[model samples]
Target: MANNPFKYGTIVQEPYFTDRKEELATIKESLNSANHLILISPRRFGKTSLILKAVHATKRPYIFINVQRAVSTADLAELIVKETLKRYPLERIKSFLKHFRIIPTISINPITNGIDVTFNPGVDSNILLEDALGLLEMVSTKKERLIAVFDEFQEILTLEKGIDKKLRAIMQEQSLVNYVFLGSQESMMTSIFEKVKSPFYHFGQLMHLKKIPFEDFHQYVQEGLSAVTTESNDLAKRILNITGCHPDYIQQLAASVWDLLNYKKLDREADAVDTAMTQLIAVHDLDFERLWTGFTKNERRILRDLATLGKLSSKDGYATSTTYSTASRMLKAGYLIKTETYEIEDPFFKNWLLTRLS
Candidate 1:
């Protein structure tokens, strides 16, 4: 039996992985250059995958922390130290951290068998963050190079004011450590890194990852299905169009298509895709409904306009219900993304929305 050519719902590696060659190269260069970078993309654009690939490619010892999983400043502090120890030697780490006094009280985490770096919750969160940065800086100097990737980094905005400034100040002292701040919340991330008021203003190189081009996505889909049947590439292109080239959706839809064809022995490729798409939308129905409930009446109208008109100002524009400022806010909030013009970021959401609004 042949292997499954598609992967979804998790990180796809190697032959299963499609593109992002340029992104992979840039991250490697940044690792060597100590280039702090924030990799921003809408969810499912494979930004995290590129970071992981670079971790393996770069010679520098690398640590990856998912910032969203951490709830408090202490959690963030504990996370940094724990992930770092996974790569560095324990005694050497303890010896190095002693100089910075980041984790003065260390005890083994009974659950994971890893040491937990405890700090006083009474202390200012900024101070705790500062100590964590100090520890990373000391380790970087000792190791010659250390790269830390903070995924879902925009969650830091949930903290108290000036956390951005404190972090920027902390990172500035580090000479050998490279930081990659990866985020899906584009608006929040923009405020943190692009707004002049943001302490992270101009702190790193900005990279806005674009959706996969039709040619690459189309060709990749074709290649993946090549072994199963002598199907037309047109069927693959339809899947890309259906998913708007959203990497995760494309992979998910494609995986389902492959299964219907190979497992259920569907005849026509287009029929198989149609069945797969129905299943895909059904699976995502609850998620779409949850998103629907979060919007205001104006935002809902805007989505309806985007679906029918494909741009603002058809039948009812945002200008009618809300100001252009509101539209801009939505863009920053990641409810919409602008390409040739503004549209719903999730193609599937637009489809579901049109059904309700129409």
Candidate 2:
């Protein structure tokens, strides 16, 4: 009779969100100490949600920008200017940004007074990037500490050569601003932040999001699906195992199972879970197909081995490290995430792979 409590396809907020207590604590500690951090995780692992939660919980004056679609460094400047205006008034923010010798054109709509920002098409993009980071510095001066989050921060790699050097140069000067860079692509993120050759190498502490532990996940589900008549606790464990304890998939699978029981009136828990999984796989068919087709023959072989064997080590079918490297590139790209052992990135994807090869 009630709406499904489990949520996916968007940000999962409080009450509905499962345990991230330790993560929250760590994030808060970083913010309080004015430490810059790289919040790294694979796509859909809830990096955005965690960032939002941590920012809100800290109650700091912050600008959150997602530069995932930014086409150039100039575009990135416009994005930061727009997002900064969203948080602080245009007059106030513009005053701070105006100090920069190379700032974007900031304008307000005549009727709505909504802020819009842009840069000259002919200007050097590096200058635009410098001016953008300068704006953040100006704002940080207004408060004891300002929090700035650039979600999908790894996407900056495509902007221009030495963007990292430029960004690092500007950001390292901010003594009062606490910055959190959230990125979904672990490989690119790591390369940018961890490699010794990187400008951002050791610039900030690293935080990798692990899958929610089974005990915590089990308890969270049990609490949410109250007044359980069936053995939903056992079902929760199965769901976690099936989904590989992935943050988004756990919510997705839980939602599917909940939907079957609530709306479809599925009486059997097993039946509900099975139907849920089938429907989920249906939704992901095209995605999995694209992924499967993208791999080369050798890559396909590696995937088939992974799907068939469930793990990539100590088996007769075990491929050598070099053999796996070609496929393992996907691991760096976050297509395949590492756990206690090597496996496919997505559990449902493994199922789809099995179906395709079977």
Candidate 3:
């Protein structure tokens, strides 16, 4: 067990080790009652990690599938079959292949000793979906429950036009398997699940994953910092204040501080922390450039205004103004986050903007 407290931009699955206990309990309760669920959050907010943890804690057989790269029905079916067969025995897999009407072929490599199972596409794509559902239903019958989590579920909506309706129909017809649709990109996710006119409307429980509490984070960082050097509370607060409870940024900032501590055992005046923050921003220069590259001139100007002035509203305070509308759209797209007194998104980018503008 290393003394590392930051799991930057990665999934943490250990129950006793993670901090989202209440969210896990809510998911567990929903799964226990056979309720379908949709977990939503912004990018990098630990949705995948939380879903993986929930599936691990569940009292049923579960299959996890990542469809972020899937573009068609064929891709979706292939990924599902591949993950499902990984847990079954050869004989069972062969038996399963018969239900799919596709032969299960295995390949052996003499050099690497790696085995690969290849699935022959059946006569039609519908058969693939049917067989997948059948396999899940069969497993659920014998195992009491079966949970299938589709990560990056919003991508399914982008798959051809009618695919969303088709997939919804398949899930709606299922009586045994429980689905956990997990996705970031809050606006798209809401459109998929919350729109009354959509096929997936009212299909599952909506759950939003929030950032880890400040108290929990403070304790975690304190323990990690204590292991290296005796830093003051003010230093830790300053670091967190800049990161604003973003898990990835917090971990990254802490890792930078640890690297500084490695060189000099202690620094109590906070210069090391400040230097680490500066280096972190400098190292991420390309990220801001990429973000700016994707924006229109007006959008970029709106962002620049936020970066310079900290918040924005119409000069006339009218909701119908172009400024208000543009700002609202950017907020929904996750380009800006509106707080009580400020509008800032991506703390690192904000800091970078201040430095560049200054």
Preferred candidate (TM-score higher): 1 or 3: 1
What tens-digit string does per-residue lDDT give for candidate 2 at 1-358? 5767788868888877878889999999888886798899777878888878988987778888887869888888888778877877666875777676676677777888787788778887777777777777777664457788888888888877788888898888878778889888878898888999999998887999887788998887765555433667777887888888887888888887877766646767667667788888999898888887888777777677778886654344545875668656868766677766667877788878877788
Regions of candidate 3 where Cα sits further than 4 Å from its true position = 1-3, 15-17, 101-123, 265-269, 286-290, 293-297, 308-310, 315-320, 331-333, 337-343
User: What tens-digit string does per-residue lDDT give for candidate 1 at 1-358?
Assistant: 7767878767767876777788888877777775798888777678887788888876668888898888887788878877777878888787767665444577888998877766766766666677777777777764568888889899987755666777787888788788999998777887788998778888889898878788888889998877666674867888888777778878877888888877756767668777877676677899999988988877776777778778776344335445466677788778887766886787767777766675
Instruction: Output the TM-score of candidate 2.
Output: 0.91
Residue pairs with backbone overlap in model 3: none
Q: What is the C-alpha RMSD of each candidate to the true structure, in Å?
A: 2.7, 2.5, 3.2
Candidate 1 lDDT: 0.77
Which of candidates 1 and 2 is the stronger one according to lDDT?
2
TM-score of each prediction: 0.88, 0.91, 0.87
Higher-scoring candidate on TM-score, 1 or 2: 2
Off by over 4 Å in 1: 100-111, 120-124, 265-267, 286-297, 317-323, 353-358
Cα lDDT tens digits for candidate 3, 29-57: 98887679999977777888888787787
**Cα lDDT for residue 47, model 3?**
88
lDDT score, candidate 3: 0.73
Q: Quick one: best lDDT, which candidate?
A: 2
